[model samples]
Target: MPFLRENSGKFSPEKIGALIMVLFPLALLLIRALNGSFTPPTPFGAPPGLGAGPGLGAGPGLGGVDPALGARPLVEVIRFIGDWAIRLLLITLAVTPARRLFNWPKLLIARRTLGLGAALLVGIHFTFYLIDIGSLGMAAREIVLRIYLTIGFVALVIFAAMASTSWDGAVRRLGGERWKHLHALVYPATALGILHFFMQQKLDVTEPTLMAGLFVWLMGWRVMQRYGRGTGLANMLALAVAAGVLTALIEAGWYAVATGVDPTRVLAANLAFDYKISPAWWVAGSGAAVALASEIVLRLRPLPVRRAARA
Candidate 1:
């Protein structure tokens, strides 16, 4: 934290945010380790079935005798981290909108750090995936064979390029225009990442569906901003509501295609309070909350008063 507080540039709101971004994935890894996901006893890759050794039960560590070892799969941690990478990348994209929405100009400083943090997490996720598959060769083979992996790998490559050019020197060298063009790759990278998420999941695509919904909203907001129409609180709130509705429709469609479930049932489930809160509600709530906060803040800031002096 001391290092985090040290002067790098002008103090910006994103400074603290950048530090948190670094710590978040590390904390997740720590949690996974504490839950016994990292007690493999050996440095080698986990073979086909984890905890499948001759004497070991189907859990973490050798012989599965460690009390720390639970039934949770270590490979799931890879998915968790990968999901976080995608989320962080989305957050990075959201920074500009957030700054505009909240009138927090200093937030601009945090965007690059967030992008790089996402790239770093993605790199770690990919490393664990390679380890899980046993070797680089096998990983490469799988990527070639699997469309989802190919999509994810392409996104990673784009992130890598963006990360490499994130410095002042790169801006100076490439000129701002070219650099902006290159960084625009984040758009397609995000699409591919979301697609990869949808494809890789065998079941329970609620999370990916929410992510896609958020992505759609973010892009939609950008378009609105471009056309100079959606910068106000009311418009923003409307966008949020629309996005939530779109999220529900997307989820319903996916279930219809993948599971042969009645899309009407899925849509009706959004109206029902019989189940846990769905992602659509979460997305809508988040958007509305942000919009309300911005409205409140704008109202609270007092206008300068002019005094008339009496002779």
Candidate 2:
């Protein structure tokens, strides 16, 4: 009901919009379960079946998800659900920046719904993992023994905590400041989510790199705001540069530490225009576009008449 009702107990446009946002992905899952034509995109040149390994298969083990139906590859279906969880989580983080940039106070209503929806999807993602293994005890042991799984589990726990406390009564009990500080764990939770994603990749890491870059941009903006550098054009552009460089470093760093690749070569490959544009450039371009849009919005804002009396 919170997804459909505004804070004032009225059914407002923002609430309706948030409900739509929440349900759309579930519908996508249903479609994927019934018809596999709408499979989520894979990273880079990887085939759809690239990572279809163990614990993911077209069998009767899907805990009612019925990944066995349709052409939905079990691994891809699960990955699709998990990716949407991350997407929703990222969108939740983007809401505040977007509201501030566009001067849309109504946008705040969607944040709770978005965050909780993301939590729900993550719950489902984990549920599918359980189904894949077909045993809770085994899954528990795996989650305990596997570092990547542990990272994802911790992130899920954070999301669950935030979701449980999203109500007004909980906020009253915890106090607004304390509640906010508790929810601040989302940043690190998301970092863990990204790490889990990268570590699980058997092939291309293009999507994980891009998602991490976007997270970097969001955090950069938050840091700028904290330092009183307002999200002005110059500051935003500078943040974009920093985020891009950091993104490249992140990609190169992962390759260096996780694989036998040369970090310097990977980092330098980002500047190779002759090949594909790296995820770093995409993140920078996305950030620069947002900065330009904010600049335009500021300039186009209505000017106050000198003779106008104070309200």
Candidate 3:
């Protein structure tokens, strides 16, 4: 197969890995469609299993159900898959910023594929969500009016616009500056997506918090790049601010977990005051502070000069 051919004259592990990463999800979907095993396989012959046996109808076998639950197993599975797909997309976007901080420039190549895959997964997720909503005999207007649905729709539209122009041809046509300007839409798209999740989630804000932190880190890098690493007093002040923010967020998160309250809901509902804090917020804030401190120290510390002798 042309795909299997190693044409780069180097080890093709990355090429092979990339292909497998792209195909594996689709392969799983195909298997699920054919076998009707929406959920992951359980322990061997475990009760309420997805095996091909008489117990299937009793809720353990393929398509087995009580019929009164109103929703199929397949539908639930699709929703779960879609949720995780968006989460993966957010993580993929973070990869670039993370790599840059670590000085790994080669990671840039994988960013486009990761982004496109995220868009594809989100598109599939929207399709499934729409299907499920329609199956309930609900009006399209009702679904659109939902906060989560509306935000999700906006996020998808942004992703679609970006994805359409992801190719080299589109980049050339738009010019690099214009293309980059357009791509900045990703920031809002991610924010909307996080909002959607924050609204839809029942209890934990862990995932949304992590995504928010990543966004902060990515954006902070840009700020640092713009401002020459601040002077001694400026750096101290910046680090102090970061430390205070981190401490507050950590304390709030701890309080929420202790009281069994949902931090996401608190933030979403009370936009005016009482900002929600999460572990991710702390991690991002503290990490950025430390990174900034390191950068400043490295820049200020004079390096030993090498002496050159002319004979």
lDDT of 2 at 91: 89
Q: For candidate 2, write residues 248-299 as lDDT tens digits.
A: 9999988888777999999988998775788999999999999999778756
Candidate 3 accuracy as TM-score: 0.60
**TM-score of each predicted structure versus truth:** 0.81, 0.85, 0.60
Candidate 1 stretches greater than 4 Å from native: 1-13, 37-72, 302-311
**lDDT, candidate 3, 166-185, per-residue tens:** 98899899999999998989
lDDT of each: 0.73, 0.78, 0.55
Total clashing residue pairs per candidate?
0, 0, 2
For candidate 3, the C-alpha RMSD (Å) to the true structure equals 10.4
The lDDT of model 3 is 0.55
Worst 10 residues of 3 by lDDT: 302-311
Which pairs of residues have clashing backbones in candidate 2?
Answer: none
Question: Candidate 1, clashing residue pairs?
Answer: none
Error of 3 at 178 (Å): 1.9
Evaluated with TM-score, which candidate comes out highest?
2
